[model samples]
Target: MDVQPGPEREDSHVDSDVSASTPLRVALLGAGVVGGAVARHLTERADDMAARVGAPLALVGIAVRRPGRDRSDLGVDPSLVTTDAEQLVTRADLVVEVIGGIEPARSLILRAMEHGASVVTANKALLAEDGPRLYAAAAEHRVDLYYEAAVAGAIPLLRPLRESLAGDEVRKVLGIVNGTTNYVLDKMDTSGAGFEDAVEQAQALGYAEADPTADVEGFDAAAKAAILASLAFHTRVSGSDVHREGITDVTPADVAAAREMDCVVKLLSICERTDAGVSVRVHPAMIPRSHPLAGVRDAFNAVFVEADAAGQLMFYGRGAGGEPTASAVLGDLVAVARHRVGGGLGPGESSYADLPILPMGDAQTRYYVSLDVADRSGVLAKVAAAFAEHNVSIETVRQRMVPDERDGDRHDVGEATGNSNARANLVIVTHAAPDAALSATVESLRTLDVVRGVNSVMRVEGS
Candidate 1:
């Protein structure tokens, strides 16, 4: 595949003149999948990158947990790998960190910046949790700290928010950021697989981790949402600030209900600027089937941004894997290399707008509720009354009888056998309402003796 240059490539180059004898030295941390890909990228595109930056770039060193591990897939000299990460940081003019999570990655990048080296990273968790500190350290050292691969692997989201829409007001950034959960949900919708079954299939296909709680429980998407929210709103948003709802609770019945309503279930990461403040959340949401993000299927990611000038912009691509993420990391590497060779840097700290993170209760959105109720009179009226009491307006309501197998052959045996025969399914789609009110309504509905259970409660987006 032909690699495309990022948005930063279109900008005019710096005027700094560097001696042709000086080769740009790059240090890579974490010789894992993405780091390996970066090493390969540096080797494969050496001539093009060198010509663009006006100097040959060299991978001087690589830091890894196990220095003796074979990295033939990267197509680089195995002798370059070392376990001494601290020593590697000091020897390079530029550093690329693909060592995800917090701790060492954070300290190593800071040390590199302190050593007068520009840094690029794909660590979204570190950026979301300690972005301000890293930004401060980079500013203190007067060096570049770029993280384009942090949020949506191959998609150019960070650069667009930082540059393309710099002048425009970005009011909202809603996305399907986690490919693991998205793939599971897509499989559940298309193949009629249950949540656990879909997740198992995703794991076998390498789309989900063995311990899939991080992706399925919304932790991964929440981290990315926090990072994207901080960038879009120019505020300090952490992983704890995001309201997360996993896809673990979504069943095949819920997927069927969504299809019946001309929608699809997706794990959505929503970041919106409200009158109160900025709201950030990651949840399984029901999006209209025709929405741009709804079409993003297995192992793919897409971010939908709403800005004053740009209106609606959608960025879609592979959200994970070694090569795709390396593309983003390398793009930042080239930009930072150009800046270094020109004796300049990219934009400085961006946390000027300190927007408060709104509580989940204050964040408003439509909801989809599925309940199992006794097949008796006044059940629908009682459920509707509970929503009415909470001031939740209904957009659509669907109810179907589940016949007992002992009675006779049902209209659809495949569908009716899934749920209890004694109970019926009542699916309701409500208009926008306060989260507190919706919770209260759900609580009230649960109190009804005729209501067997609250099957599922999901948010509705892109209506």
Candidate 2:
């Protein structure tokens, strides 16, 4: 392995010449949307970034899975583009990986670090799945591993949690991290659109993908939650460890119920420190309309972090985009370049604490439950009894009588013992309780004779 000497920073006003120091050669692992932007930025802004890093940051090569794809529009020399990713990482001082996923990307990154090159990656899925291994490799090789783009795009989130708040103890991190689901939910709340309609609108507006399963089914947010929890709690939490629930089940009725209480439903990624350990979860949650997170409409993302010393901090911006993600990647690239010139590595993983991952059932949170029940007398009492049986306490309850539409029957609550098909929509909000207790309570309610069906059950997050 070859060693590069450090570069000293000159005064900002000076037109500092860096001809004496060796150029930091950077290799890009993909040329997709984000990778193309990174390549363009590095090539176009080479002079500016070189001055900032007190050295020339050179784009030596671009590794593409497909060979002979017309990337001349990205302003890279066609000779620099090649299909051989494994060979490209060998002759570089630093590698920037935007090629997402688990396989070849992971193998290439590991090989890069093994060959004495620093790495900057925007691969969130790889990080959430196997961060410890990559971090360990970087540590063993004494090279900097920076990934500022993995979570929250250009929002500058992971750095604050990993570096800025290194001194303070972060107690909780709650974020609207997924833009696709957020856009869908916001559309449903504002336009009274059904789930499928909102999703279609999102797709038409470019907020969602053709196959939005990963975003809608909470997998994307769950992966982000896993990353946030690992950083905030100083633990190793994988995507599988996160308790996930998607927004596909959020109905227009649920949206209307949220409006009735001056709230909005959002797919939230929540990470918190608990008595047992740390808890991480992703799901559609009800936040008060006045809350900062609730007002985060459209596809924008925001994260609220609570720390012991810093008190409260919120980072907000475009959570996902080609240019935005490229910005983050370039930021990390410069940082790694500077580290190479300065002969020092940036902060690596800090999972020395290695706290346990608390079970989702043991996590405590409030819930909003809507149930359809027979409008006969003693129905509310029976529901209350079921909650008590599970030791869950109710905070507020609202009921409305609706005519049963089955077979066009008009049932009245005032018919006494007559043949009435009236049914009650019981909306119950509960205080904080264990999730297991709440889930068990819902199960018991389903078995009750008076209960018709569980209309919707959603967690209530953010004050």
Candidate 3:
């Protein structure tokens, strides 16, 4: 950082240049990929960023777990790197937190605001878990807390919902938010790979972590879902409030079944407003190919927002990566820095609506159920009765007969039970109903004597 003379030196006079363009000393937490990109931008594009922020931006320090580690290629002065994140947070006009998770990152950010410095963070877990605390700190301290990168990387999603669409009513927010699961599901859809093989491919390609539980199991997307729902609905929604289902249960049969119905399987983050209240959930769902979110293949992310005045809006782009996430961090840095220099705060948390998060069972949705049934008369009637037992109305039903091993030919499901020994694949699509009712229908089907097995059960969305 540029060594600015302290007022303790008792200078006779200061120039208007120094007064007008005071350097916004920035402390970066986490010298990982995202932090490295942020550092490079501050170093390589200092003049450009300063011009945009109406003040000079200076890196006070880069905090890391190991200051002695080889971050030589990260493009920052060695002297400016330190292990003391606590002290680093105290000594800057703005703090950029890329270190994810709760605990220390949360504590450090709270400390930064307490010390009277604004914060810009991409820590989604911390935000989704306890965002109200951070917002309260910023509001009480009169500081800015901007986190555009927390949701959709560089898509500029949160600002639009938080600012541009602030006047409008957001009815729903559906997205393919987790890149790792999206890549896995997309691979399964296109290459016909099984869930395990697709996940292996995603790990080899760096789309997933060594321990891919967070991404594949939907916890990562759930955190992002909570954040999106909170912003879109003007309510306080936390990670626990969001219903989470993983992609681990997705099978090759599920992928093929989706395609047979002109649909694709995606790990979707869905938030909606119902008559009861708002609902937030993340799960692997079957959506028609015509839907915009279905076309978002591979590791890309897209959020489809439906609002009263804005109608339907789709934000699409690279969802993850160091540089893309840092782009969002830098954007927030400039905005927060401008607020610091110009003497004002940007928007804080707005939970004025304070809508209660509805239970997952109450959310209205459709179901695509695949059943292995005995190839006998009255099988269809018995299955239909199972759905009716739970008040779930079936929209469509089709049967795929299993081929006889004796001859590579399909056996007719309508054939007499004495002549046919094959089981039939009975596919049923249900009309939109309460999720609990649809779930109960699946359970009831499992109990019927005509049903041999429940092959797959997936939610149908985007129609």
Give the alpha carbon lDDT tens digit for every residue of 319-385 in model 1.
9999899999999998998888778889966878898889999889898898878665667788889
Cα RMSD, each candidate: 5.7, 5.1, 3.1
lDDT of all predictions: 0.84, 0.86, 0.88
Candidate 2 RMSD to the real structure? 5.1
Give me the candidate number with maximum lDDT.
Answer: 3
Colliding residue pairs in candidate 3 = none
TM-score of 2: 0.93
Off by over 4 Å in 2: 1-20, 404-417
lDDT of 2 by residue, 148-182 (tens): 89888899999889999999899999999999999
Count clashing residue pairs per candidate. Answer: 0, 3, 0
List TM-score per model, in order. 0.91, 0.93, 0.95
Clashes of 3: 0
lDDT of 1 at 43: 79
Off-target runs (Cα >4 Å) in candidate 1 are 1-17, 404-423
Lowest summed lDDT window (length 10), candidate 1: 2-11
Query: Which scores higher on TM-score, 2 or 3?
Result: 3
Residue pairs clashing in model 1 are none
